[model samples]
Target: MAGVGLVHQGRTRQYEVKVTAYVLFSCFVAAMGGLLFGYDLGITGGVTSMDPFLIKFFPSVYKQMKLEKAHENGPYCRFNNELLTLFTSSLYLAALVASLFASNTTRILGRKTSMFLGGLFFLVGALLNGFAVNVAMLIIGRLLLGFGVGYSNQSVPVYLSEMAPPNIRGALNMGFQMMITIGIFFANLINYLTAAQENGWRYSLGMGAVPALLLCIASLFLGDTPNSMIERGEYGRAKIILHKIRGTQDVDDEFQDLIDVIEVARQVAHPWRNITQPKYRPQLTLCSFIPFFQQLTGINVIMFYAPVLFQSLGFGDDASLMSAVIAVAVNVMATMVSILSVDKFGRRVLFLEGGTQMLLCQVAVGTLIALKFGVKGEGSFTKSEADLLLLFICLFVAAFAWSWGPLSWLVPSEICPLEVRSAGQSINVAVNMLFTFGIAQVFLPMLCYLKFGLFFFFAGFLVMMTIFVALLLPETKNVPIEEMNSVWNSHWFWTKFVPQEVVSDHSSSNCKPSP
Candidate 1:
């Protein structure tokens, strides 16, 4: 905004610029946190099914049933159903609680530094989980994993939001979530490859350490976010970082803006309460509610329990696990669509369309499940119905992957002002994990009790979600970070849904344009 020429009435070579290595590399390392997050989510269903894992942790169940063969299927194999639920949801509980203190962590340590610490803990947790001998040990491992996830979840997106140029910000941030899908696919592939071995679960769980280590080491090369440096009154370092990230020596005006904004914080006397002030309240409200609905979309439930969900849909154990793999793979492919289209389509359109599609898929899944299970009874899926179920599930997976999965992380990351961004992102991510905890804790049970009806709950939530997006969600496609507040304050219908550039209203000009 300083030396950068933001206004362009026509296409130019400069306007079609490519991303720099520094931004790309920084996001790459930072997004490894997401990779580990996905790895943890995916490995659970596969690892829990591992015979050696069960025999090691639930010896009582193993001995009580007098089971001898590894492939044997019986009640003994199902001994730790509730315990597995605890294992799956424990990290989110830790994430929800840890986020309260994350603001302090990010402020003191710096964003990249916070991620480094997160990666360290993730490594610790992954190793512990890999070697766990009891339920308590496994739970402890998940707690550490949850803490690491909260730290990185809070840091990475905001870090990317700060560093990336606004023109491709949505696509870049969406790519961060795409890395998550890759992690899920990688974990599923590992599980599928090793689900047959006696002690393969250990290998599958331990593989999480590879990305953790990569993140920890790669993050060391990355600099602190320009926002974080500016917050600490490191003007010299902040200017240098801006120049390096913005790829221009003429960043003085942008640097001056940072100084001025921080001075505003000083004048406030209570900067911690700044976000709750009327001026910032709407965006804060957006930050708070977005995460609630994001989880209510039930993406986590599907990600965490795809194998189990497929099993209930009448697939055999091996087939169910394979179906979960296909589901994750589809998720990755769909996220690619988002990564390419988000900046082009604008945020508001995708949010509305994707939410509606997900709602429809939920209805279809519920209806088919009701028809198959309610009318015909359980374990009675016709081949035609089974094919349709998988089709609908993949479509649902695609719907979430392209729309909610990436946007959930992106919008909230950039929605807050820089002064409160660390805390804001942390709070939103914490809310995400909190809802994820409850939903996940309830998901398996609902599948058991509600059977086909579990989807209606998701659909019901989506109805509200779709309307909210259409009415309230702001289009932030190419808006610069400094101008996010102005975006939130813009008019309700006519201008907000359309990017400020395309709209005739000049009132939204408060935001600094990206060159």
Candidate 2:
């Protein structure tokens, strides 16, 4: 009896520790989705600059076509800047297409399989992109890469949310976005280091294959979501997987919870249909538009065209690439700060503060450009003036990284209930891609025609986002996601009794779902 009692005690402690560890472990794995997403964004910036001779580095099939070099009238007087941006935007275009079916893919393939397929696309596409000799081949590669990124971006958050302990879901999901920023930053740094070397850009583009390979390997080890397993009629396996993941010995309560969620989801009708229903409209609105807003902030314009932007500021090619590296470094560091503060500071505070900081930084940048470049003098800002301009741009990227970058996804994941999660996320991701595509197409023309006024436009959007978040968005840190809808619907009633910041406490018996 004494030995049995000690064994039971040891098991209980092990279970306690594993619950947190397993969720975090899953977060680490899911974050590869974000890493690949970032890698796609980073690689394109460097690759686009070397377009004409890029064919020379490719295999024979891809190496045949080259940009028509002009004669003494300056070979390539007008660079195909617009076409290069289109190539960059092609990834988002593919993402838009993939996102339309991403939710269905998740329902059919399950999260693990969907992620695995995403990785497969990433590996194949990265290889094809690296060896592309023509624009058509490169665009096709981008399309494949986009499919991978879109699918992973759509599925990874859902996987993390389903696997996480309710109390820490926000933090874990935010980690996905942080990984994205870090991935982009890392990819840019690699490109900068290799910018002067032969095939440097090609190798940079190929680096996306690494995370895809890692994700493919990791998926083989992770168990499918318990909810997905139960929905697919694999209850016994789900129960066992939940027991292992959550480290619960009895597993009765957790199993029941899973069953209840699966049943609710089953009765919810086609998840996409649920979004148009009255009950889900608010969440649909929040999820879809938040990501849309994040993209509309013109961050991608900076990422895709940073080298061009810096050159317009009077820096030569080397200086422009170096400045981009500095901006990317600042972005990476700011994401680290966001990860540390996400759990402690609360989502609302970060969004509010981050938005405000970006507004100021963007305004400063716009003012500098208006004063320096808008007037046609020496055709550029002076060196010190250029340095100050780069500083503000770095500040803007850093501010965006810390707040909008992570919170956009985290908030959406929390705002929607499990019954409509897959559909809601799909719509959100679709909007994200659409805006990414639209901005990529229009921004260059806007920059060429409207000049400094474009910043004012984005600044106005930021102001609107700030106001919307302050009045309507709820603080979701530490809240049980199942109860979030109810809290949001009756926030006025709850605020009368509970603190405004405390949405739902899992420890309280009263936190049970209403009948």
Candidate 3:
């Protein structure tokens, strides 16, 4: 279909572009931001479990840990200190606040600028965390890291979606999540290698700087997307970059579509307010709900506390960390499955299948834990039982990696129109951060009280979200970004909310440009 133009229903000729090396390079650079985020996610749990790190920053927790080893406390209550949890959750609280401001920054300064600034902030934060000698310094460093994550998470997915060819957009956008899984695997591997060394926690936390530096230097050389260029009124530069990325000069049809969309976007003085209008209800709902549901999958709590959870399950320190490494390795491999088949299999199929797989795994794991350690948490798992538990947990992680992990970021970024794209993505990031913060803060306490019931709670949410996807989410495979509104206009439930005339006018204007 590329290199040949075809007129559809008397509208302007439609042109498809080939993926060029420049586009791949730009996407790879942008996805480095996710590596920074995922490293932080994986490193914090391992660092918290280290004896030296706990003795230095959380002496109370270290005392509790020692007492639990002597069988003086319940296994569920060993690491339930509020201050210890704060060390991990504070970053997400900061990220939630920063994401709101990042929306405007991504819109005004462009996606590349936001990414560059994010790298600088992450660089500083990583250094501060590496050298921190007290709890205050460590929390401050975490806050800075949160600001960096907020900015990058808001922009990178949008940049990837805008730059990728329509046919491969889902696969390209998933590069961000693929990087996240790889980062988690690397962090867990590093933690396993460094756990026996002196000041090993510092090494695990500080390695985040490597990806930050890479993203910073790479973003400077990469050109902004054509959509972003047009949004900023850089018409000449937009066409030049479009031709270069598309690998052809016959980009007039796609170029004109971008211009027409920007003209409509320019008329709206307040994008935030515009997103709240009734017609945008579907977009707003997806932005708010998808991230919320993704967190309820319990993936973060597992990723954030894998080492601690394994320790509480009666694994020795070295064994616990090794289990975490294996689990994260499974996560990385499963995410590769998503990148290879997302566009081919489509989003909804992955969502439904993965949700069912995760649901079964969660219920099985819960039953195993409940049978091994009853309500009082006084029992321990046998060797065979512990291995079976690990197997189920790995299965759950693999299911999520191929489904919700990547789609959560991809769908929200691609669904929103240009006018509300930044704001929609900001909302997505904000909701994600908010839920992540809440879960991080409460997980330890919930573990203390709820015991084995927590997984069932998450499984209940998984059921509801799977049904939501099947009924509400339409197929978006191979749809051009500029024509996404047509998806809502045709969907059974969403069509009533979206005005047909508005959709028609927008499509016609994009297809048949003005004289």
Candidate 4:
């Protein structure tokens, strides 16, 4: 079979393909993992703010919120109870641990299997959460949901990257992030609708099962990635699936490339140790720091507690819920922008532009809050000031949606060679969950102590991360997944770690016919 050959960074590769409906359907199904994650993120904040839920599960927090409502002093600290925050943070803590185990599950059982397990766990967790009669049941349910998130988050991005064509990988990979924002929007909308109901939080919590079931059913129909099939020694089946996905029988060059990477992968008995080698330093660094920086951007603070933040700013309960819905709506729309332009504009452009926008908005919001509420949290915002605050917050959310939110997942998943892909993604998920847990647990207290200064703190992180990208990260725009080493070799800094000989050998080896 003849294939189209193209040169990138002085390396020539051949892979001809067209986007087909099967590929799109598979990617869409796999991206549902993000919806499960996003729903959890969006739902918790609103549920915590619901009068009935808080009064039932967190009576002390409810009392504190009411006390702050009557008197305007220290409103930022009203939701700062240790137990109250634990309910939100525990899922991430569980996810951090679950991600480690999910690495092996993803590598051995296949991406589809991992996704199925995730959906199953999420389904049970959602049901338990809805029916919980006590704090113990609630925390347990959250733990199960965390397990779901860990497994799905670990595998979904990798699956999407593996299944997508090189030209469209960025956009397809962004599908996960797109679903995340959609999930957030739906959760916030549900919360708004149910906030007035007697058991509204239960409905909000249970609604997570809807997406979970969809993912489970979808996973059953999706094929494992050709890369995973090759890794598991299903060479003939991998080639067949590749032909189907590429919508062409002329897939020899691409199939050979998969075989080459999997051959290298087979030699490394311990993928975790293999990734630690000096040659993989660039991938290792990105896998660790991107997710770390992503969490520090303080997006989750807004995502997990937008309602609480709005309420603290002097909006009433219904108003706060509605504002959260609007914020997530902007998030969903901005993610659509990312989906449309990621492949065309490239990753670094969006990262820098989005970071700059977010930093400015965060600064603007901090300044507004400080001017209106005086850092002691004793004053309240006027209606106009409150509306302005919500506007700035939405802008910040939008900036993050297009840049750090999706790219963080996309870049790490696509950069690693197949040998270390699962391990790298596991590290990505673990770091993301660790910091997410930390922020979820501490955000309220930080808000209380830092007051308006909290925005400045996150703004500082945005500065460092943007600089990090400018100085260190290379453009991974349309690079083939198997040939990512060339991207590093061409970078002025990363080139030092990836020797020319290594990249040349890697490239030459990929052209060899499969055994």
Q: Which one wins on lDDT?
A: 4
TM-score of each: 0.88, 0.86, 0.96, 0.96
lDDT tens digits by residue: candidate 1, 1-515? 32222322221112223467777888778888889888887888777655677678765544533442331332213333566678889999998877777767787678887889889989999999888777888999999999988888878888888778778788878767888899898888898889888878889988898899989889989988777888778878888877777776766655665676666544554435776766566567777888899899877756887765665456776887888899899999999999999989988888888899899989998898777667323336777788888888899889888898899899988877666776678778888989988887777656655556778989999999889888777687776666555565465743333354431122223334443
lDDT per model vs. reference: 0.76, 0.73, 0.89, 0.90
Error of 2 at 12 (Å): 22
Stronger candidate by TM-score (1 vs 4): 4
Q: What tens-digit string does per-residue lDDT give for candidate 4 at 397-488? A: 99999999999999999999888899999999999999999999999989988988999999999999999999989998887787778788
Error of 1 at 464 (Å): 0.9
lDDT of 1: 0.76
* Candidate 3 local lDDT, 1-515, one digit each (tens): 36322222334445758889999999999999898888989998898889999989999899988888564347888899899999999889988998999999899889999999888889989889999998998999999999998999999999999999888899999999989988898988899999998899999988888888888988999999899989998999999999988888878777876787789988888888999998998899999999999999999877999999999878889989999999999999999999999989999999999999999999998898888887877788888888999999999999999999999999999989899999999999999999999999999999888988988989999999999999999888877777777778779999988886545244454454322
Residue pairs in clash, model 3 = none
* Winner by lDDT between candidate 4 and candidate 2: 4
Clashes of 1: 0
lDDT score of model 4?
A: 0.90
Clashes of each: 0, 1, 0, 0
TM-score of 2: 0.86
Model 4 RMSD to the real structure?
Answer: 2.5
Candidate 3's C-alpha lDDT?
A: 0.89
lDDT of 2 by residue, 176-283 (tens): 877887777787778777777777777887778888899999988888888778878899998887776666566565566457656767887778886777666567
